[model samples]
Target chain A: MKRTLRKARLLLGVTYAEMMEYRAELYLWALSGIMPFILMGLWAKAAGETPMGMPPVDFVRYFLAVFVVRQMTMVWVVWDFEYDVVNGQLSPRLLHPLNPVWRYVASHVGERFSRIPFVTALMGIFFLLYPKAWWVPAPGTLALAILAMLVAFIMRFVMQYAFAMLAFWTERANAIEDLWFTLYLFLSGYIAPLEMFPPAVREATLYTPFPYLVYVPAKLLAGQPVPALTTGFLVTLAWGLVFLALQQVLWRTGLRRYSAMGA
Target chain B: MHGEHYVPEPMPSLNGSRYAVAWRRFWLSSLAAEAEYRLNFILATTNSLLALAGSIFGLHLFFRTGYRLGGWSWEEALLVMGVFTLLDGFASALLNPNLNRIVSHIRDGTMDFILLKPMDSQFWVSARHFSLWGVPNVLFGLITLGYAGKKLGFGWTEWAQGSLPVALAVLILYSLWFALAATSVWFVKIYNVTFVLRSFLEAGRFPISAFPQPSRFFFTFILPVAFLTTVPAESMLGRTGAGNVAWAGVTAILLLLLSRWFWRFSLRFYTSASS
Candidate 1:
């Protein structure tokens, strides 16, 4: 186990370095991924005085927090999978000793490093854009927010990876992506708080993994301590494990149906 | 073989004489191609319908909770959404098919052929690609707009007063589409600029009044989403004030001239990616 973990770290580092080769393109990719900021402005306006139970500052605080969390959570695995699988670039990834998921995650997180400047600039812009948000997360909650971000990354990665893996069976992965994006728009608080959903929708969304991916961390960053940070973390961790297992099953299942054609 | 292979038969200067025929030929061929895959086309149309429904779902969720969106009555809001959808469908159906190809043309170097053409290249490129697929969305927007008109119960006079604003809205919409399409010069990786453009366009779905005043001022005056939806819709439903229609004409002219100048400027970068 120790040897595998060490090997995994080395492999991860190498794959990340490969992605850094496209550092300039990667930063633009991350900045371009952040369309949620525009939506956040609109929602913040609607929440004037009080937005769906969040006070005015909380509205500012929640969305700005969301801007950062959503940026961090976004993964472009669908585009990657479509480009590779549709174009027959999967053979090399398949031949690697490590799990293909690791290679994929490594490239993704490696690309995230290029995004640091953009994220910092975005936070600075948001602060300048809204100077009245008087609350800040405690150090402890900030720690939990960071942890939730990690869990959220792995969990959302698995979910998007699974969605992309469907390209093995169908060519319309982007159209499929559109459907999932529609769900994320409402369920994940990309547009509005999950709290603002009609009670039934909100209730159903909370019990699922979607909020853990974005909204939970947004809440934590906004200093709205969820009932237990531990609960959110454990839930995300559990979902991550479940998806990890499910991904293994999917990998085996999908590979059996796979036929190789050289690009 | 290299020089002569697949050479076109030169016909009488390739002038205006054959242009209309070529136009007819293009549409006829496209229609034939679309007819061959009727089922796929149907499914794609259904998906766009689903997307339109999703936008409606957003307005529904909001109005289910509140009566007015940014001082818009429910009826007026629907009309704004309807106008937004109409302008959007028109822009996508008409302009995008022609202009969206510019990025690929730049990347692949095929745009040189366009540059060599005698006619206005931008006009040729912008109008050449008719989206037969966009017909459904156009029909869908018309249906929604019709419904909203019925709900509003406006007579011919209102629509008469509304015509200038509507035309101005369409002009501004086209100009904005052209401006974004023009940005392909600086950014080769601009295949998705329209995606970001459309995301901002979604703001027009709700009244600008629905946002705070600062946001309202920016998206409306600067970004001019205000000209796209709220201005025209308000002309029909609310007061046909001097403020709305006057700015509509002025902004439309400014945007058109500026987009034309921008397109000309970007053309300098067109060293033709193709040999």
Candidate 2:
């Protein structure tokens, strides 16, 4: 574990330097999550007279919280993983003493950390433009949201990694990711808060991993009513375990198939 | 690369007289190349259809919560989305595929070779690599637009009146995209700006008035996404004013000239990799 942590530190440093080298690209990528801001405007306008049990101001705050929560939980490791698998880049990593997953985890975490300052600057500018949307959550709720966001990040990462492993079997793995992204955009508190969803759809979405990734965390941050913090944590943990197990099975089978194919 | 097959023929003059024929040959070559990847074509078509479904479902859910979004009825919003999909299809089919080539050329300094060619470099880089697979997206967009127009009782008169502004809107979009791509000359790492542009383009999926007060103008003038999708939809619905069409035309001309000037200016600073 100590060695793993040490390697993670080194990987994080290298990734930070590499990310800085393409600072313009990194900045644009960070800003690409602006969909929430756009949706916020649409919803806020629709809720001009309180359309879905929430007023326009409430929509503003909810989407602002959702934007920050999303930035914190965003993951794109599947694309990288797909590239590595297809290009035979994973073979060298497999020989490393440390697990290759840790390298990805470190890189993603590093990128997230690098984005903090940019988002902070953006939030500052955003608050200037719409100060009414800025409100402090309760201290306890803030802590809970942070924990939920960490869990959400892990769940998303593992789920994406499992999906990326499908690249070992199919060339159209990114297409599958694109499909998942479409679903997530609607179901994952992106288009609107989950509370705004019809009760039947809301109940069904709670059973899926999409809400845990964005909705639950944003809900926690907004200090809205939730399905109990413990319940969310447990559900997220269960999903993470399922995805990890899936990854293990796929990784083993994929590796064998990969070797057979002479990669 | 398949580009080797495109050998320049002997010409009488070097005043870019061969541009039309060259573009046609390149388009045919691209179509032939993409024909080899049958599965990729199928997947691309599936992705486009899936995207159309997602947009429809999202609009369904949005309208379910309220009768209208930002004063536009559900059908009007659908029309905006249809226009957006049509323009986005044009981007993928014509503009975006060449964007990747431009970035690589800038990065590896192969842009100099293209510049040395007798043909216009900007035209060459911008018009090359026609994505035949994305043609279905255009068809899909037209079908969606037709469906929405049918629901709204729109007829040929509305379309005929809207055609000029729509054509100008397309020109404005292409010029804006060219200016964005030309930034790679000075900023070699602007490849991901395409993603940013796509995000900005997504704002066109709805009426510009649907955005916040401050951003309505931002999308209208600064980025001009309003002209790209919203104005076209309004023209189709007969909601557009004569002044709006005039403004759209002026913006298209100014942006086209500005991009041309910028492309020429940036070429002076481009130091070739071979040098």
Candidate 3:
């Protein structure tokens, strides 16, 4: 276990060093992540007139929390996986004893580590900018919220992994990524709350795990508790398991098709 | 990492013959390149349509609840939102989309390719990306404005009188794009800057008046977002008078000239990786 942990540490250092070499390039995407902050500003102002549900103050806290959770939970593994899988890059990973998923998650987690400081500073700004709305929650709530957020990130990344593997079955996997991105933009509480959505649409989301990925954690962080984390975390665990299984299924089916086709 | 940029002194806006030639060359080839990948073009267009639908969906939902937002009735606010879309289309269509890839150039040290050519580097970079796919949104936005205006009870005469200012609003919008795009020199991570600017653009969809009085004040003078979509919509609706139209034109021209100067100024700070 110590050796594995050390190996993980070494991997993260190497990845961060490699990425930092093109720091400006990585910043391009980091900059794109500012979209959530922008949306927060617009909606916060609009909702502040008569808050979304709680109060004007509630909208402020909710959006600011959402932004922080968003920055923390973000990952681009699905995108990288699609590109790599379609290009036959996965073959080398399969050859190795190491699980490729751990490596990919390590790289992403390293990137997220670098970004967390920025979001922490942003939370400070959020508090300074809206003193009345945003505040520190109780220690227990904060702990639960953090755990839910971690579960949410796990849920999101796994779903992304499964969806991205669809590249094996189809060409132009980037298109699939784009489709999922659009869904996340609206459905995952990135744009608006699940509660704000139309009834049927919100109902459909209950079956899907989209809310656990962002909305639930943001809701928790915002002091709302949101359908309660006890249920949410268990559901997130279920979704993650399902996604892991689906990825294996898809890979098996695709590899069989590939071999039969004499590729 | 040697050849990156050449600072040629600006020639007066281009004498007639060469200017006409470049203008003609720009469109003819851009369409050809875009046409080469029909499916990708179709998919890209579809993607843009989805983005457009997202914005429109918000507006539809807002009005579905009530008639007015920020004191402007649904028709008025919707018109402003359409103008926001149109101006956004123009920016992404021309300036922002084109000039934005400079970071890619800087990182790869490939900007030298453009610098090697006799054409001006700034001009070449500014006119680089031509996504004709953005054109439909402009047309669609205008159609939306037309529909909304009819619902709100406005006519062509109102638009004609407002066109002069709406034209100015176009220039201002373009200048803002150019100004921010040039900041690739300092920030080098220009994409995030563009996103932040876009958030302000989103703010312009609703009436400036809808914001708190302080934000309304800041939006007009400090950010000038009010002029981006709202002022144009107001004029084009024939709701505003000549003074506002004149102001839009002056602001546009001033901003345009300012952005060009800043682009030149930023060029001085740019030390390409190749260099």
Best by TM-score: 2
- lDDT string for model 3 (B1-275, tens) is 34558665554475665655675677678878877767655665676677667666665544444534566777788788778778767876786667668767766667768778777776777776577767767876787788887887777776776566567777787778778877877776444356656655667767776766666787888878888778877776666777876777778888988988997798778687756
Each candidate's DockQ score against the native complex?
0.31, 0.56, 0.26
Error of 2 at A261 (Å): 11
Cα-based lDDT for every prediction: 0.74, 0.82, 0.71
True contacts kept of each: 0.17, 0.52, 0.11
TM-scores of all predicted structures: 0.85, 0.93, 0.83
Most lDDT-accurate candidate: 2
lDDT of 1 by residue, B1-275 (tens): 67868877565565776676666666677677667766556666776687678677667655666635676777778888888777777776777777788888888888888889876776667767666667777788778877878888988877777778878988888888888888887777646466566666777888778877777788876789888888888888757587778989999999999988988899997787644
Residue-level lDDT tens digits of model 2 in A1-263: 89767777889999887777766777888788888888888888777744577888877877888888888988888889878887788888889887788888888888887888888999899999888877888999899889888988888888889888888898657767777777787778787887777789888888778888888888778877777556666777788889899999998898888742245
Which is better, 2 or 3, measured by TM-score? 2
Candidate 3 chain B weakest ten by summed lDDT: B59-68
Q: What share of the true interface contacts does candidate 3 keep?
A: 0.11
Question: Order the candidates by lDDT, highest first — what do you get?
Answer: 2, 1, 3
Q: Which candidate has the highest DockQ of all?
A: 2
lDDT (Cα) of model 2 = 0.82
**CAPRI-style grade of the A/B interface in model 2:** medium
